[model samples]
Target: MFRRHKPSSSEHKRDPAIHAPALPHNDMRSFFSLSQLVLSAGHLKPPPVLRHSKTTYFEVEILDAHSKKQICVVDKIPPSSTLLDVKHKFHKVCPQWSPSRIGLRLERNGSYLRDSVNIKALAASSIITLYFTDMGQQVTWTTVFLTEYTGPLLIYLLFYLRLSSIYDAKESARSLRHPVVHLACFCHCLHYARHLLETLFVHKISEGHTPLKNMIKGCTFYWGFTSWLAYYINHPQYTPPSFGNKQVTISALVFLLCEAGNHFINVALVHQNQSGNKGSFPSPSINPFTWLFLFVSCPNYTYEIGSWMSFTVMTQTLPVGVFALLMAIQMAQWARKKHQLYLKKCTTYRWRKRAMIPFIL
Candidate 1:
């Protein structure tokens, strides 16, 4: 009878406010309120992320080479930018200076930086300093070449036609023109015509430009030489070759051979360059004309000299001989420089190859 008394529903439902242990408002309530505030804020908006950028940028400072004066500062350049890109930016800052006419170097008198060089490679820090030189007025190499070659052709033709102003009209009409005179005209025209054609199609001329002064000087030389040579060759009193048909025939044959060889060598050089072997030492190819490459570093110059020499012998004129000699000296200088460049660039090149000659230059 004194067993357990059954709890009533009202006793089971004791007051939650009195029976439940009170939470510490300083610790639990504060933490709960703080957590609830954080959750509510998070739901409303994401927390701002303080991220650091990893991208690198560059700044370039260009100064005058001689005066050391500041040209301009190009900023915000990417790491992948090249010298060409810097040149473009510099051009924007200074529109008067063209990219081609803008020469940049590390030092005042130092060699210019190539357009292909990377800006990052040249930089010692995020900022790079360059010396700028305003290369004077420039003309395309093609324009220079065309002008140099065309003047001689037209000048030679003018003399050959024997205008009344150039030659005495009565003497020119009475004077019997030698068979060699006509032949010499043919050869001269052929030579210049071939050069014009080669300039247009065959040769791999540089994209670089020449100084306007240099082009003017070159034109003066070529036009002057053509005038001097043509004046004597086509003169009314001009004589035939000394040894008659024999000397003319032999020299003409030599000239023709040399011209053909020069053409073949130039073609081979173009092919080599097109095959991605640019600036490399040229070697002998399947073509017999190109075989001269084995003996001469500049076979084209050799053929050029040979053609002139044969022309001198064909005409047997003092002016032509003098022209040949001067041309030989000039070509020798060019060939020597080209040979030195080949040797410098290609260590494996044959030492026996002369600049222009086969054995002795």
Candidate 2:
């Protein structure tokens, strides 16, 4: 029923085999085309990849203190730590080593580094070589002071109680004890008891440990002197002072006053430490005994010497006098050293002040 028509040139040129083929859904070309289209439209982005870099750490080289031979090299140590922390790390490598036993030195002849020193605060270097020294037997300062004080207190008491065989048979049968002897025993005991108490409760003692040899030497000095004084003072032939009861009363008063003064001074110093008032010179506050600070640099030593002097006067014995004189000499030396330290540490310290005495050395 349709009229016949001639075929157009485009339709005559078109062939089914020559036409471009449509891409399949799973084809690589189809995927690439889809990715390009999404990228051009700014709808998708590539994911980020993480790459790890080599970790960096500080190096610590340890060497024998005496021989200077390499002992061990510790690597990968964190810089934000302390010498004490480093010691623990070293302890892990050498199970036998301990923090207390290890002493680290920056130089061959220099002093050992304190445990509180920070690792990062040290001089900057690629490798830090620390001299390792084994600290021998050590004891705390508190233990040394307690032992030294307690020994003298008990040893002197033994003499006063007549428990030792040093006294004669006739003297042992005496009816009543001498009043001066009784007073002397009380003063001696009180002096050492206060010292023990201060060392334990009041004083802010540093955490430094002392060598056993030094402690032995100190104990020898204290124990030997105590025995000598106790023996002579409690002797049967001991005589009262030539000035009689008046001299005894006056000396006893002086001893008690000085003992009280020393205790007050110690308390004030402890307060000073707690308040963190280090730079300024220490001045007396309500306690008049602390007024000695105005004239003398080491008023505590001055009070100590005065107490011993009063004891010497009360007993009036050659051994007691000798002990007081020797103690004075030693305390004088300590006072001078402390005075120098105060001057160095506190520039505001008065230069007119004497070391131990009020106006004389």
Best by TM-score: 1
How well is each residue in 1-361 modelled by candidate 1, as lDDT tens digits? 6989886778768856656788776889789989989988765757799999887899999999888989799999998999999999999999999888999999888998898899889989998999999888989999998999999989999999999999999999999888788888888888888999999999989887778899999999889988998888889999888799999999999999999999999888888889897668877878888899989899999999999999999988888888899899999999999989998988788898899999996
lDDT of candidates 1 onward, in order: 0.90, 0.86
The parts of candidate 2 lying over 4 Å away from their true place are: 1-57, 74-76, 92-98
Model 1 / residue 162 / CA error / Å: 0.4
The TM-score values for the models, in the order shown, are 0.82, 0.79
Give the clash count for model 2. Answer: 0
Clashing residue pair totals per candidate (backbone < 3 A): 0, 0
Candidate 2 — worst ten consecutive residues by lDDT sum?
Answer: 15-24
After aligning candidate 1 to the native by TM-score, how far in Å is the CA of 8 from where it should be? Answer: 44
In terms of lDDT, the best-performing candidate is 1
What pairs collide in candidate 2? none
